[model samples]
Target: MPVPNRPVRGVAAGVPFLAVPPTRRLDQPAPVVVAWHPMDPPRTEAAFAAALPLDGLEAWRIYLGLPLCGSRSPAGGDEELMRLGYEDAVMNLQGPIAVQGAEEFPAALGALRGQLDLGDGPLALVGGSMGSAVVLLVLTEADRADDIAAAVLVSPMAQLRPAVDATGRRYGMTYPWGPASLAVARRLDFVARVDEIVRHGQPAVRLIVGARDDPDGFLAPGQRLVAGLADRYDDPARADLVVVADMAHALAEEPGVEPAPQTAPAAAVDRHAVHWLRRHLGGTAAPGLGAAGEEP
Candidate 1:
């Protein structure tokens, strides 16, 4: 079955989302896979949905807009975001986004489930870059942490301090890593909180990174996260890392606030994500699935 020409779009509990229904099992309640877009390219919910639709996966693929992003951007838009980043990247931008995104998700999720008539069973999660930090926060701190069945993180910000450092280097500005920012970094460091992530359900986790992404910011922390999870998981294979060749940090072009064509790297990441969700969510992949240009 082909995906709808336009996905079901709505705002639930103050969170905007794009929902792609399963090709199979329309009448029955389907498992949900909620995803958060990165602060980088393919940043908005619609853009992220276009980038990684998880084509042919038999589940509800819900792309959620992060707080202060997409339709929820402040009055000054990207300019405001940049201003916040300059003011205090951690306290003003990253910290609030991560904390608010995680805090607001449960209500949004409940509203979505009620509105869509989705299954009450554990759902899967997917996130990219800074959005991946939101996923980690949910896994570690959300009351519904135990309700997550699986997760896939792409070019993830597993550790916030390195990402902040990388940003500082990119713009040739030294970040003032004060006590407040350092505390925020410590809270957002997923690799340091692996035990909390698996304390309840031990959800299957797969971290996918681009081979060309910054090793210090993304690759190294992802590797460390997998290693830490491996030590805790009953089956070490439940925690895995995949490095995609010829790929980089961002999945789409600059000014990624709108939906755009999916890139090859994004497609590759989607393939891995779909396969993982299928295995863990008890769904089968459709024939010829996981190909670029295919719809959800």
Candidate 2:
């Protein structure tokens, strides 16, 4: 399939998104894959789309901006985000983003369905770092959990406690885990809620981590998630982990708020994600084309 020169930019239910339609399926209802970006490089919807455009895949790739990110950032910008992390990374930052992002997804999806030629078929999800937490929350808690066909997580925050601790270690400060924070941690901890994901549909889940990501925070938890889901999957291969060499936590260079040229590591991630989505969503389709405009 030929790649589009640019993605169709739009807002759905107040969420900014960069959408790329299937190259040859403008007349048909195409499979849709909604993605969320990490807090690191390729942090925004446009940037993530540039990094992992999923070219050649016969699906609509819609990259959505996470809460308090991109156009939704506070007035103080990155400084405000840092302050929130310093105040209480879990309660003030990570926890809220995951919860809000998950909560807002259904309305965003519905709006996108109304605005685009999206299929009613099972959806696919992709997320990175903290964004992955939102994806897990959706799988475990969303009313449409059973409508998920596949998911791909990069440097995922599968367990929240370890991630908070790891952040503390990196910044040389200890996070005083209190009752409220602990409760948030438990709620965001997807490892402990594997049964919920399995109860829904046990969608094909692929976790990709960089070789240099924090071992305790990201790598180990991702591995644990795959292991937890192993027995639950009828085809064990549906749940697996892939470690990319020469890659770190962030997928692109610094100042990842805007769209930029893709990095080597990001290209590698794109390949893995595209392959996984193609394999899983290849045969799926929407019943009819909606009001989405022509491909860009």
> What's the TM-score of every candidate structure?
0.93, 0.91
Task: Name the 10 consecutive residues with the lowest summed lDDT in model 2.
Answer: 287-296
State the weakest 10-residue window (summed lDDT) of model 1.
Answer: 287-296
lDDT of 1 by residue, 55-130 (tens): 8787889999999998999999988999988999899989999999899999999998877777664599999987
Where model 1 places Cα greater than 4 Å from the true spot, the runs are 1-6, 26-28, 287-296
Q: What's the true lDDT of residue 233 in model 2?
A: 81
lDDT for each residue of candidate 2 in 93-200, tens digit (9 for 90 to 100): 898999999999999999988787575755899999988999999999999799999999998999999988887888899999999999999998888999999988
- TM-score for candidate 1, please give it: 0.93
| Each prediction's whole-model lDDT (CA) | 0.87, 0.85
For model 2, the superposed segments whose C-alpha errors exceed 4 Å read: 1-6, 26-28, 283-296
Best by lDDT: 1
**lDDT at position 54, candidate 1:** 90
lDDT of candidate model 2 versus the reference: 0.85
